[model samples]
Target: MEAESGKHIQKAEGTKLEQSSFEPSALSFQLKIGFDGKRAANNLTGLGNYSRSLIEHLAHQFPENQYLVYSPKVKSSKQIDAFFKLKNIELKLPLNGRFLWRSLNILKDLSRDEVKIYHGLSHEIPFAIQHTRIKSVVTIHDLIFLRFPRYFKYIDRKLYLLKSRYACKHANKIIAISEKTKADIVEFYKIDPDKIQVIYQSCDDSFKMPFNKETLSRIRATYKLPEKYILNVGTIEERKNLKLIVQALKEVNEAYKLVVIGKQTKYFKTVEKEIEKLGLKNRILFLKNIPFSDLPGIYQMASVFAYPSFYEGFGIPIIEALYSNVPVVAATGSCLEEAGGPDSLYVSPTDSTGLAAAINQILSSEQQQARMKKKGLEFVQKFNNPLVTQQLMDSYKALLNTANY
Candidate 1:
């Protein structure tokens, strides 16, 4: 009986496809969506995490819709392959060519697949898709290249402006990860504010779960973690403002230490110079190549999490700290307030003295620590996967309902 029902449904779907070829009005039915999965397939950073989380949550929440995940070059990664295990998702690769396909030929594949909607999980959409029947959405994570142009090379900044402007102007709807990013899109591109939607991203569920004492013990021993420390996670770069944290440490109690976990770059040398000049070699530790699975325990064990970045689209580490029941101290110049919530303390990005005071307050007062932890855990509940998934589905429905598609 199940097999018979499946056959009937397949036949009905075939009929719908035939009708949609000639009439886009047929889009009122179940959606066939295409996603630019380049970051999810290749990166392990913010963009990749956003892509994976969105695909996983969307597929779980709305299994009736068909999803095609396309990449410039389809390679097998354990992270990407896990998403393919979902019966509703298919891995689509470039059919025409390589470099040119990103800029030119992906539109042909979208047409061939008969996708009603295409979403660029990163900051780009194929230029040709705007002229076709497919409605498109682009997620612009940040306009950092424009905001912090000093950090970007000349050619990189120009290309970023060109592609981001094209996507903002041409796509059916835009998803900005935070209100800061949405405002930047309007200010930099001179695009209408009504065209953008602000959506929040959260840390993985691993941070929310309780860590086993044995696992925590193992991680502590492996890293030789100090009993009391402030933790910061991100690349050791100037923009992340690790130097501010190091300077703050000098003013704090001698028992407290700072542990940072990220890959070292040339910027680390500059950071090292500051640390040495301040005679803080014993007070700071930089952990390299830590396994992803161990991050939760690391967060849980910290006395406080410090995120002193000068700017960001959103600070994922702040939410991670909240979920791990650790209090947070973050810089004030960007979207850190949104990520840190009301319970977390904020200080100027450049004020090492203010940062020191904030960290001292958390470290000294047990009552303050407990109150911040409770409020933060409650705040992060709004970003749970189920809620975020429903919000995304609503956007998809809204885009498809528009008369333009």
Candidate 2:
């Protein structure tokens, strides 16, 4: 009796499949989404943060979509670039060794395996994969290489410009983190404006809530933070405009120290030398690679968070600072205004005096700080988890509509 019932169910399912116009995939799924996992589970920066958040969001939101993470392969065409190394790389990711192996060789396998959508989490797309069945989508974080080439090495800038130009030209769709970035891509690459979509980046979930006083004290002790210090946290690269931030600190009262949280690259020494020249050695502290968990407390302890970077795709740190209720004095131009919205005190990135004056105003006026704190929280509220995740899903759906997934 059981054998007869099983045969009946099988016969019915076969009939349905025969009648239906769409057939189930030869594999378990219809679509495959690929991410450039070059930085995943290793040292987490803005790109890593963006990658990790989006991966988790995608996995949770659309469980049916089969996702493939494309990382670098170890053996072929590998040049160990020291500039990419961070101390935390070994702490978590076991797949770090296999990365170069995948990027060089296994990318070709995507076509063999029938991947439908390939998304470059960073600006780069594997040049070898263009002939494959996979449709490419590239996210252009910024055109800073074109806009501020002087801040980068000549060769590095040229390489980024070339690669990004190719990616923009070839990809099926382009994702821009801000409107300013989309505009820059259009002007520089001369791509069709209709091909790009402006999607804002969301702050990390860890920054959403406040930190405890004990944790703040521990972070202060661990980093040896100065009493009553101001904070600036991001990469200590030249494009961050640290020279002006250091110069601006000179005009403020001696009670406040300018605390920077990021590592030093070669070009960053220019800012360090200026700090010494201005007799600010004792007043400015550089702390690199703080754990992300502790940054919220560090931000909370900050009298104000001053970020006067000349360029950005979208200022995630500004959103993080605001979420922690830290008053912000961020630069006005580019996407800083978009990220900080109306809540931040926008100073011209090149004007040290403007930055200093803005800081002084925020520091001296308690009412202004209070108002900014309130407004900052409110500003960040719109950029919460659901909205950003939903926006990205909508973009993916739109791309599918335009192209065969």
Candidate 3:
């Protein structure tokens, strides 16, 4: 699967000029790079993890370059604290009118900082970036609101479309987290496929590290986790399809329970009703506000990881589960196959029986579990920190090396 996806990624990148090997020392001078740091400082989920992980790895791999993280305000946490500890990274905050500064006024600061390249870690870049000397890049994580319009409010969809379309039209480069997202960008916004690059995301180092049995046991007791259970990690929402798992639990063995860890939305109430309808109130566990430090341990201790989300740009938890050495079973119809690789099991998002069978197959056979764990870990190394960071840096270098820039 790694080789197969590599061919697709290589083809996606073939449109770019100067497809040369990238080495930090080959450059004659240092570069100044800036990022839209809103999610890195404030968001703790998908976008935030993407921002922090990319910035951290870039700074580590190329310490000669300076990374400027610009945001309106920052919320302090252990993750943010560790991020600031990197010597090459500096955080920039607005003077006043926080929203206005990030949108329209930030170009003035970029000129003063001599930022050679500015990357929007989420779905937006500052307005009027094209008029300035800075080369801009924006990562469109997913078009979920556009793809599943029923899940979002009318006004929110309008706002998202406005910002995303403007960014796609104006930015020098567009980064899509998965090929699925890249295809969506071209289809929905009518952008040229050559203008976009598909770069996969990597999970945090915490998930890749080994934990002692005592640590795993402590986390198990802390969460009161079942001895054998299927783990699902993500927000509890309709698109996440938690209820499908609830319905599948009826077919799974009674000895195995379902553990969920995420924030709840109104859709959670609907899931609770399904649990009641199926008499699974006691068989399911919903955990919220779990600390980041304990998540890897929780993943390592689970019997199997299940993600039946109807759609996603790329499923980070699937890779996180793979890194934790847990077998993964995720829903089809999106980029999950790319994330989980070929060895991992996949089922239709709406097929509860198939999901149950896949879950039970792993739980019942130790040999099957071992084979998946080995192949999954080997396949996921393609998204390791060095490789992913270098791919991103190559994009930046390509933009800077362009004749127009």
The parts of candidate 1 lying over 4 Å away from their true place are 1-29
| Model 2 misplaced stretches (Cα beyond 4 Å) | 1-30, 41-43, 73-107, 128-132
Q: Give the top-scoring candidate (lDDT).
A: 3
TM-score of 1: 0.91
Model 1 C-alpha lDDT per residue in residues 1-405, reported as the tens digit of each score: 011100111111111011112222333327788898777656766788778778867766676677778776544445555555555656666655567776668888888878999999888999878899989999998999999999888999999889989999999999998999999999999889998998888788788897999999999999999998889999888789998998999998788899999988788988999999999999898898887779999999999999999999988888899999999999998999998898899999999999999999999999999999999999988777788788888998898888455
Residues 1-405, model 2: lDDT tens digits: 011110111111111011222222333554567677665533356676687577656655554565555543211111112211211111111232444443345555566446677788778777766676667788999988789877777999988887789899988789999999999999999999999988788876778877777887898899898879899998888778889989999999789999998878876879879988999999988887676668788888899999999889888899889898999999877888888878788988899999999999999989999999998899888788778878887787787787654
Question: TM-score for all predictions?
Answer: 0.91, 0.82, 0.91
Any idea how many clashes model 2 has?
Answer: 9
Each model's lDDT: 0.82, 0.73, 0.87
lDDT of 1 at 323: 92
Compared with the true structure, the alpha-carbon lDDT of candidate 2 equals 0.73
The alpha-carbon lDDT assigned to residue 383 of candidate 3 equals 89
- Model 3: ten consecutive residues of lowest lDDT: 1-10
TM-score of 2: 0.82
